[model samples]
Target: MPDISPLLALPGAVAGAGTTADHYGDLVAEQRMLAAGRAIVDLSDRGVITVTGPDRLTWLDSLTSQSLATLDAGQSAETLLLDPNGRLEHSIRIIDDGVTAWLLVEASQTAALAAWLDRMRFMLRVEVADVSQQWATLGQLLPVGSPPLVEPAAPNGVPLVWHDPWSAVQVGGWQYAAEDGHPAAEFPAVEILVERDRLAEVGVAARAGELPVAGALALEALRIAAWRPRFGGEVDDRTIPHELDWLRSAVHLSKGCYRGQETVAKVHNLGHPPRRLVMLHLDGSDALLPGHGAPVLHEGAAVGTITSSARHHELGPIALAVVKRSLDPAAALVVEVDGVAIAAAQQVIVPTDAGATAGVPRLPRLGAVQRPQA
Candidate 1:
């Protein structure tokens, strides 16, 4: 949101044009660069908040969805800040450096989230500051097929990095995505902190072929293909982590009390999420792309709406949608884009049966005292 025009005016690159792109001319080439893990994306649209104080870690653990009280230096985790009524309010990508906890959030949420955190620091030794104006965000992928998990080293004197944990379930975390061969297992994503003043330098270096640079568009396509959940797009005020399969990495099931923890436990253990997430493989052979909020239909009835849709180089146009949990998994669906119906097939990311103790016994109905004879 700062004066990034200088960065955009560099040669051989196309302007981002709002909420998309930081690419160097060719979209396909930029996408290839990202998929190969050879390019960095200028994710400056994200914001950073710094939490400094002795009580930072413990205080965060007591208020968020993830357990952070024992987190060590340079470690990463994703946590959700839910309302008291168990609805999502914010999702934070977090990492600590023993002295500071850096929270990476959407730019729109930066100041608001920081202000809220400050207000909640009653009688606590914690200080929250929106550092987005001082720091920027950059994204890159870890080495493909690397056996050991890698942590991103600070770049350009910026000393924080938050590695994405969506690739697998963390200890004490629950996974609502019941499908076999989850696509995120291969999404080796990492986000790094960078000084704001280095933006033009990065753009210049990228233009001179000294460093590879792509755009947010490429990364988003891969994210959709991988079925990753994101804030502002995949989430809303009514969203619960279980609906997005976010429990896999963000919610620690056995963590001590926090806002919305009761709803998380009850939904996972005894009740089912009211809705479910699914990947829609759209019929884009017609070159039609569906926009966000496009209706997803089954037999002429609107069952859901497209949250995020993208045209990946390899996968073409694909989308992620949230539909009623009772919608039949095998039912053929359609997405309406520009008044044309695009046929879609459901890839069961979160199955209808997703929940803990799904097979647990249930009590008999109140009016039925005895079993009826067959």
Candidate 2:
């Protein structure tokens, strides 16, 4: 993870500490060009994992939250690993190409995830290995109507390209967002995994002005606009799929029991999620953007924390936060950035009543009996 990207040497490349360049001087123009499929983002900070053996699919399906038993070759999917109490642990972007299943994940998470998968192999025919040293990941816009700007790597006879599953709800997924509008489909991303040598060639092409390179910040802006909840930004020890409306993409409600299946089922079918995710439209008059984990204040009361924030090309300053589900959606909010409280307007992502979908009747405690569902 020691700044592996060759694009770091590009002109105007303001490389982040131990990460890729944040921008090529102008983030706005970077976003525009990247969104048009004319540029690519250096995602070298991400890591790659590969699973092989005939039992790979079922082994993964039995261990994670996705229904991967039927995942077809060349098909794209996503899955999550959770603690026993159903807290967010790791989010994986998956693509299987018959012979091997490729996993793209945060570099910080690669070692732990691979180690855990290795421990769980227990008599199974599957073998897990961290192949990050042998591969490179690059991200680009591949919206539905257009062709890819560059081809993906398929060293094993199938390209290791993972389409963003957030584009639509999966078959076993359920959506709890109160609003009908979600812009996820507009940000069609395809993760390309190439051999290390091939990426070196891309770096050469980039230096020759043949391959336009946009920084990770540009892609992050578009991701924020799409209302996508990234594991690195939104996920925490207490995060549950229900809180982020992640059920819309990552969770398979009906999948066979995984480690946290009970909590996931109980939260979705019989109880409400304790918190809901919201988007805050910040007042940019101060020209200050709140960093991640900034305190979200509702009338001077610390109600929640900002997870991710970005200045969209058109929307200006915006952020995603998780707040108490009971808080009024119309409530005016403030985000404190370095002790300066910035006024923010709230936009709903998940509603106050996002769960209990089973509609099971609840009985009153002791003498006071509640009415049953009719």
Candidate 3:
């Protein structure tokens, strides 16, 4: 039988197996590293789909949540592919390189998305191709400004140029070319991928060994802390874009018609979303926090459900909850998972106030005070 050990190693990573995923044993070692410290995750497991041709921009704009027309060269945006019923099929990062649009998404979703897009193509001139094998995906966190960043040369090459607050970038493919006196003839242009490989090169001495594999647990924790919402957790068939606060990142309201546009507009202009996403502090040991879909209770009533959970080394356990907007943030809630009661406290990370909607919070104006009549 073909060696199945490499796959086994990933789950055994928490136990400290080995340096490389050279075999099943090594993968186990990799997993341990990922859970404990910082591990450079080879996101090759993710997928890349390229959309090229004259109608690429227009075609994408008609489908996704973000405004594509305004996406200049070297910039990128996160968008969602939603079913006609408004359920999320996948969450994608759209990178515009001035030549082609590249979508980064879960590997499992790639084939389905490509097929969906192909079916929609009638008179619109566009070509969709899966380029997963041609590209290698890498991720890492590194000190900012380690190397002077260069923009993608191709017009449609770079997408979403803004820096992640954590100073990481998800990039595709690595090229080797002759250049000035650098140790490596060619290095990864993307910061995250470069950092990961650099860690591998230096090994334990450079703190590479300390980095743990960022499993789903850790990834969920980081995202929840950043107040980012995942598509599958926060979105569904009944959800409109505005309901999940997606308008802040996705959804160009001014853009012309697309599927479910009517419901999105009507809900935003005429009413408030019935449910909202919020962060919760789960009061318990790391092991007690409920997993996803666990019910949230307020007093004796069921208020909402837990969408995600994570155990921070410093903060104990925490979770993201979807609850009724009318539910008081001050109200006490509990997450009961597997017979363990995890206490929860709600926090409004994304404010629903009108003042916040206007833009940056305005500070009080200070000027010479005039004496007022008593």
lDDT of 1 by residue, 90-207 (tens): 9999998888898999877887899999999999999999987787778877665542121334632335767799988899887767557788876788887777777777777766
Once fitted onto the true fold, the runs of candidate 2 whose alpha carbons sit more than 4 angstroms away are 364-374
Error of 3 at 172 (Å): 28
**TM-score of candidate 3 versus the correct structure, residues matched by position:** 0.69
User: Candidate 3 lDDT (Cα, whole model)?
Assistant: 0.55
Better of 1 and 3 by lDDT: 1
Clashes of each: 0, 0, 36
lDDT of 2 by residue, 201-294 (tens): 7878888889888888889888988888999889888999999999988889887889999999999999998888988899998889999889
Q: What clash count does candidate 2 reach? A: 0
Candidate 2, residue 304: how far the Cα is off, in Å: 0.5
lDDT of predicted model 1: 0.82
Please name the candidate that would achieve the greatest TM-score relative to the true structure: 2
In order, the Cα lDDT scores of the candidates are 0.82, 0.87, 0.55
Q: Estimate the TM-score of every prediction.
A: 0.92, 0.96, 0.69
Query: Compared with the true structure, what per-residue lDDT tens digits does model 3 show for residues 48-146?
Result: 778888788888988875578656666667666666655556777776666777776666678888888888888988999887655434443322354
Segments of candidate 1 deviating more than 4 angstroms: 16-22, 144-159, 356-359, 365-368, 371-374
Ranking by TM-score: 2, 1, 3
